[model samples]
Target: MKTKRMNPFKPTAGGEPPLLIGRNRVIRDFEKGLDNGVGAPGRIMLITGARGTGKTVMLTVLGDKARERGWEVLEETASSGLCERLVSELRTKEGLMDKLTIRPSVSFAGASVSLGEAELSPKRMPETLRKAMAARLDILEKRSSGLLISIDEAQAASMEDMIAIATAIQHQIRERRNIAIIFAGLPQMVSDLYNDEVITFLRRARLNVLSDVSLDEVRNAFSQTFADSQMTISDSQISVAADVTKGYPYMIQLVGYYIWDAADIRDSWVVTDEDVKNGIDEAHYDLDNAVCIPELQGLSKTDREYLEAMSQSDGPSATAEVARRMGKSAQYAATYRKRLLDAYVIRETERGEVDFAVPFLREYLRKKS
Candidate 1:
C-alpha cells in the first residue's frame, strides 16, 4: 500500500481547511452579488466573529470567488495607514498606463543610432485619495472588470482610514461603478465600527456573524477529508471527533490534524478509535496554549476575574450570580460583563444569562483558577 503523502488537515488559525464545513449561505450570497454587479446587497459585507472563528478564512474565500469570476481582488488588513496603502496601490496601477516607450533613431551607413527615447506621458493621478481610487476604478471599468476590496482585521483600522474607504466606495456606488468592499473583524470591533458616525454608510452593509457550525456539517467534512487522505475510520469514530470539536471551526481542524498524525505514528493505514482518543488530549493542550491563553492574557484583571467566576457554572451563568461570587456590585460586574461580551470572550444565551463562547474554555479556566 502507498503511504499517504502528508497530512491534509490545516489546524492553524487563518489556514484554509481542505473542506469548509459550514458557510454555504455566505458563499452563495457573495456569488450572487458579484453576478448582480454594482448596488447588490452582497457587494458590501461585514463578517464578525471571535478570534478562531474563521473570519480570515471567509475573507479568503470571498476573494477567491471574486477572482474566479474575472474580477480584480485587493486584500489588506485594516491596520494603521490603510488609507495611505490603498492610495499607493491605486497610484501604482495608475503608473501602468504609461508602460509603452518609443525610441527615435537615425540610420547612418546601414547602422541605426538611437538619439533619444520618448515615452508615453504618465497620466495624472488625482491629488485626493478618494479621487485617486476613482481614477483607478475608471481604468478597470473600461475593461469590464470589477474591483473587490477585502479588509481583514478591520477592527484595528483607524477611523479616518475607514471613513476614506467608505466614502470612496460610496462614490463608486453612486456612479454605478463596479466595486465591492468586504470587511472581517472581531464582533465587538465590528460593532464599534458600525457605530462610528463617519462610516455610518457601512451600517447597511450585509452582516454575517459566524457562530458554531452544525455537527452534521462537521461530521461530513471529517468523513470526506479522511477518505480523500486515504485514511478510514468508523462512523462512530467520526462522531467522536466531531463532538470533540464542539462545532468550532479551528478545533475541528486541530482535532483532525492531530488524529491524522496519530494514525501516522502507529504506521496504520486506517485510523482507529485509540488514535482519536490519544489525539484529543494533544489537540486540547495545543488549543489552550495557542488560543485560550493568549486570549485571556489580553484581558484586564477584572475581565479575567469575571471569566473565572463564570467558569464555576456548568452552563450559562447569570450576571447577578457571577457578580455575587466576585464580591462586587452589580454595576461593577456589569462593566466587565459588557467588556467580555464585546470582546467575544462570552456570549449571552438569554436575558441575564452569559456563557463562554469558546468551546472548552470553561474547563480550561477552571483548571487555571
Candidate 2:
C-alpha cells in the first residue's frame, strides 16, 4: 500500500496558504476595529508591500474576518468603470431595500388574479454613485450590518474611480452608516494615493506595511505545515528550507511546495536535506521565470541599472557607495533610489542603506548580469 501525497504550500501570488504566519497582530486589530462600530480607524485601511510579501493574503484574511462579523464583503479590482460597477452592485441590490409586493387584480367575473411578485421601487433611483450608496446604506443600516469593500492591486485603479469610492465611503461615515474599505497594493501605489489631494482621506487610513517574516517563523510554518499533512521533516531540513526562502512569504511557500514534492512522499514520506536543496534550486528557477522577469520588464532602464549596481554588494549597500559604483552623481542615484523603493524592487535597511526587498532578487540579478 502507498500513501497519497498532498502539497500544503501555496506559492502563487495572492493565493492563501494553509497557515498565514507573521500577520496575526494586524488581523486581530482589524477585527477589534470592526467590533468597535462604524468609525473605527482600522475599518478604512491600506496595505502596502513589495511583491511576494503577502499583502493580498492579508486582505483576504481581513475580508474573512469582516464576513464573520456579519458584514457584506465585496471584492473589487480598480479598473475602468470601477465606480460604475460599484454603483451597479448597489443598484442591483435595491430589491433588498424595498419590500416585495404581490398585487391582486379583480376581474369583471369577480375572480381575483394575482400578479407575480415584484419589488417596490423608490420614487427616484439616485443617478450618482454617492447618492445610490447613501440610499443603499440606509437600507443596510436598518439590518444592523455593514459593508466591507476590499480592493486589490489598487495601483491600477483610475483616479476618478478612486475618488468616487472614497467619496461614497466618506458620505457613509458622516451619515453614521456601517461601512469599511480596505485596499492592498504595491508600495508605490500607496505613495501615489497618499500624494493625491483628491483622495487625501486615504492618508488618514490605517497604513500597514507587510514586512518579511522571521526565519524562525518560516521554520515553524514549514515544519507545522508539513506535519499537518502526516509527514515529518528533520529540523536540519526545515532550517535549510527556511534559510533558502529568506522569510519572504511567497518564497516560503515556493520552497515548501517544491521540497514537499521532492520528498518522494509515496515512498519515504520524509523530506531530507537533499530534497530541500534541490527544491530551493527548482523554486529559484520558477521564481525567475514567473516573477523576476515580469517585474523587471516593467521598470525603466535606469531602474534595472541601479539594481544591477546594487547587486554587486554582498550585503545591504550604502546609497552613496552604490551611486559611486554606478559612476553617477549622488543626486542621480537618489532619484533612482526613490524610484526603485517606490517600485518595491529594493528597500532601505537603514537611513542610507538599501537591500533587495524580495528574497533572492539579488542573486537573480547577479546571475542575469
lDDT (CA) per prediction: 0.83, 0.80
What is the Å distance of residue 333 in model 1 from its true position? 1.7
Model 2, 249-368: lDDT tens per residue? 888888889888887643667777778788899999888887788778878888888999999998999999999988999999899999888777888899999998775778889998
Q: What's the lDDT for candidate 1? A: 0.83
* Model 1 poorest ten-residue lDDT run: 117-126
Candidate 1 wrongly placed segments (more than 4 Å): 96-127
Tell me the TM-score of model 2. 0.85
Error of model 1, residue 147, in angstroms: 0.9
lDDT of 2 at 364: 86
